[model samples]
Target: MIIVIVALGGGVAGGYALSYQQAQQSVLKTSVPKELAPVIAAYETVTNNYYKSVNTTKLTDGAIKGMLATLDDPYSVYLQNNDKTNLDDTISASFGGIGATIQQNHDSLSIASILPDTPAKKAGMQVGDVLLKVNGKDVSKQTVSKAVAKIRGKIGTTVAVTVKRGSKQATFSMKRQKITVDTVTGQLASANKQVGVITISTFSEPTVKQFKATVKKLRKEGAKSFVLDLRQNPGGMMSAALSISSMFSKNGQTVLQVEDRNGAKEVYKAGKKLDDGFKVTEKTAVLIDGNSASASEITAAALHQNSNIPLVGEKSFGKGTVQNVGEMGSNKELKLTIAKWLTPNGTWINHKGLTPDIKVDYPAAAKITLINATQLKPGDKGSDVKSLQQMLTALKVGSVTVNSQYDDATQAAVKTFQQANKLDATGTADQDTLATLAQKLSAQLTKDDPMMKAAVDAVAK
Candidate 1:
């Protein structure tokens, strides 16, 4: 009588929330354990005899969390309203918002990135602008999730956001729209135009469509081979993985296998229709890193086993369990592990990841620490300050000491960077300054990505 929401492209296929009748029926069919009589008595005693007022909602949520905590499983979680909404948005890959990703560091929430053609970009919202308020309500102390929930709303509605950039605060009122994330992006390799590199960040409903179009476009542009990069990809929809695998597999070929606790198994096969009437027969090499998991592993295993495609880069993140998300009333959700999944060869990669056919590690410099401070003054001292100093050194803004302490030399270097980037010449590294530094560092990393090089070399033959 347990409820389950089948994962369809990482999202629920029908209504998200369970109906009252369904919940009632499930509860009515199951008899409450007589062993819980003492637990119920404890609840009555606490509520009836407590000296101060109590929030029953918090009590109930805590009880639910405690129950889940006993399972000792990280995947099974009791999600609050905002957390549930965020997970749903991520799975669907679409949401009604200004289309900006936010990040929080040391109690400061700021814009991490902005999607192109979105209301946030149109309204001139720049990265690193520290969020101050939403709709005239102060949200400076709220968490990133709560603040984001405040920003997202029904499509066509307006949300006013106030952000602090440098020394001034600006408020922008913009209409929210449906922001569809592009999970798949492809481009012809600069070193070899005949080789196309496609990166799948995450799997979602639009992933298959986007992948099909990308393949078609690359082939039209004279790309004879492809490097499918799944590095840093935390897997999403199982449906997307199956559909994408079908593009390189024969019709009716096995893509994945699911087994429940009862030892019963379900076989998932590739469909010709899911291939969009075409087969990608070109030489393709998959690039996986330690972060690639679930759907990413499924696609990699399917292509490697079925088409004999070589896998390059490091081993994948092993995640072989399947989860079913059931929506509780009041915007809450219970995500529980339901079954285990196996690769095409019947290997369960629960904690042991797939070994790459060719392993290539990135350079040590690729592990550069990110700047996590909202601002850094001359007296500040931490790893973040050290990172800023290193970035300033790499950019050749000015000669500064690489020590963790932010001294006068660091301030001068920051000022020089600000002036060169056409920003306010503030000696302190502010949000805007930090964002610019991060972007510059990212560009350098992309140019020297060793994994990309290995992937291109593998498939460019």
Candidate 2:
């Protein structure tokens, strides 16, 4: 009787255990979708055996990350809650870092350009600098996201960076801080006192407002000519470029025309109102380089064809393709090329960039020089400086020394020349200054400097 009772007890306990296992299986079967049931069952079988012996049940974070890594798209990344918040701040154009525009080149990351006045620039970071390591870790195998995560930190904190510039490996200790990107730099040029020099880095939301204010201020200060510099601009918001271009053109003028693959065309036009308070009557010149692209090209094309603004410098970077950012589910986004743009004269500058009306190749020897000052030196005094100074004196400014020394006196005379001509106080002799100077010097000599002579002839026309 005692043996039989023990057998019955064992049977009851075994039956209870079987029932519990069936209940757990039923729950999982109901929870998993039909298509995923086989996968879930296989996972459960392995995990169950492991859990039965080890008593551990939670999934590892690394396992989750591994699943995300299987996706091939570079932009499709899995971010934790904390990382997601940081990324949002970065895309919103506000974050703390060394202030550089960076892009990934395969496994290697390269610096596109160092923002002016940022800690990166202050630390001597330059365009084309290749990042090698961060914080003592080898970043050669890391993704751009991983490298960026290691580089970014709280404002006022210091981070170490290793970069390869040509043959040398450079290490810099950079401080992290909030970087306010100065998109537009404006000043009055001494060469054409009547001309305002505006260099736009990128077209952002605030750019149009800033540009309008600068135009108004420059006109009040007596600027009658303009030189717009769009060199090395990678382009930005389309609306911003349109707004800025509108400031220079009359109403109903097309700034840019977009044509998609579906045969649909859209024309962006300028508003009738001029922002300079007065009419834009001055001759305008645009300077473009190989790095100017997209919206930068739009601005150049609009003013060039519509307003007949003469473009100087090299041909622009041919990137007239437009991209639209499409948001997929689960924070995944796609930036697909959607359309191509054309100039007002129906020129497609996709692979072939816009050719300058006046092409000026940067001298091979002058590649390292920062400023492009055109004034002649004391020893080389027969150039345009003496002629420009004389022209300035005629414009009611006091007589200049015209000694060809770029001394304090020369700079002062240039400033006075700029003031009389109603230009910004930048003492550099630019296209406008050279143009006006050529006109004054033409009376003294029959032979003309090629560029100055052209400018004088254009102004006369």
Candidate 3:
């Protein structure tokens, strides 16, 4: 038996479906088509007559990519090695590793955030710690993706990580655990305790279960109305979406329509097969942003069209096509667009995102750029310095002027921020300083997120 994973949305973040079928004979046993003879001839000529020994695998991968390029579809791609591993980790939303989000700006990689109760947090790995080595391999100059590849391994395996925290260096060794990320988070809205705000980051296989559990728990906490936040959710498994959409839909209600290449349409509905019969009868509102796509769009549209739930925020990320991911072994995979998905009303959102019923844009502070300068002293002057100054001004760190020059005022403000945040008061914007500044700015912006406020207001009304 062969199993294929079908998906919808942007490549990395999309809706997925599992399909099982009998394994077919390999194409190698069959005769080649006449049209592919030229390809075979080119391959033979390259390997047999080339000036140097040819890497057959490289030639094969390039040919596959060239064929996919003709489709001009970004979702349809050939992933190799680290890219393939990243995709699998993203889809599963679980991995065996020290749980932390690594960020790479320029040549430096550092811990962006550590998941709670994970090995990284339990091992006392703090944010902004500059990654120096992973398992004795230097990753200070590697990209975040490569660093993550090195950090992840089989569960129960021990890995050593050395990082520079402030002016000191520390090493931690911990056994990797199978970390299942909590994609769905819920709490009573701070503005309105009666309103439960549930945010689904992505639609993974475990997302539906997590969402249900959150809803149940929130309902017990005196939540009357609800806010479903799908902002920045790139979508996930189709089963999860349908099951979640069903929570607000009646049994047998149309959830979405899938049309294959042959133009045959299949309707998916909320019932025993796709839904678990759990329903949310409270008044609800949905929040969507430009990054909400595929399964996110599906659930948003379902709630809006089925139960008249209002969608608040900017337009969604338009992505309605479905893909099938085929494993080709050798740490490679081929993701190909296979079908088109539509809303219950049969609207194709491909390239045309769903318009929110109530549009609310993010505040300017939310767009504050990150400081990427490795170090900025009193004499530095550049765009990076300007960004630091701008962030400082926006954060109201001090009465510092927003300019390209990192003068004495900027240094004083940086020092003040460092002292307040418990960081070393170096008076210079180093990696630790810059990362802390970014995190603080982000936290402040999130506290006053206008979109979240809008969603709560919509639910209240």
lDDT of each candidate versus the true structure: 0.76, 0.61, 0.77
In candidate 2, position 303 carries an lDDT of 86
Residue pairs with backbone atoms closer than 3 Å in model 1 (clashes): none
Off by over 4 Å in 3: 1-31, 81-147, 151-180, 329-331
- Model 2, residue 93: C-alpha shift (Å): 11
List the candidates ranked by TM-score, beginning with the highest. Answer: 3, 1, 2
RMSD for each of the candidates:
11.4, 16.3, 11.9
Candidates 2 and 3 compared by lDDT, better number: 3
Total clashes in model 1, counting residue pairs 3 or more apart in sequence or in different chains: 0
lDDT of 3: 0.77
* Global fold similarity of model 2 (TM-score): 0.55
Question: Per-prediction TM-score, please?
Answer: 0.72, 0.55, 0.76
Candidate 2 Cα deviation (angstroms), residue 392: 36
In every candidate, how many clashes are there?
A: 0, 7, 2
Better of 1 and 3 by lDDT: 3
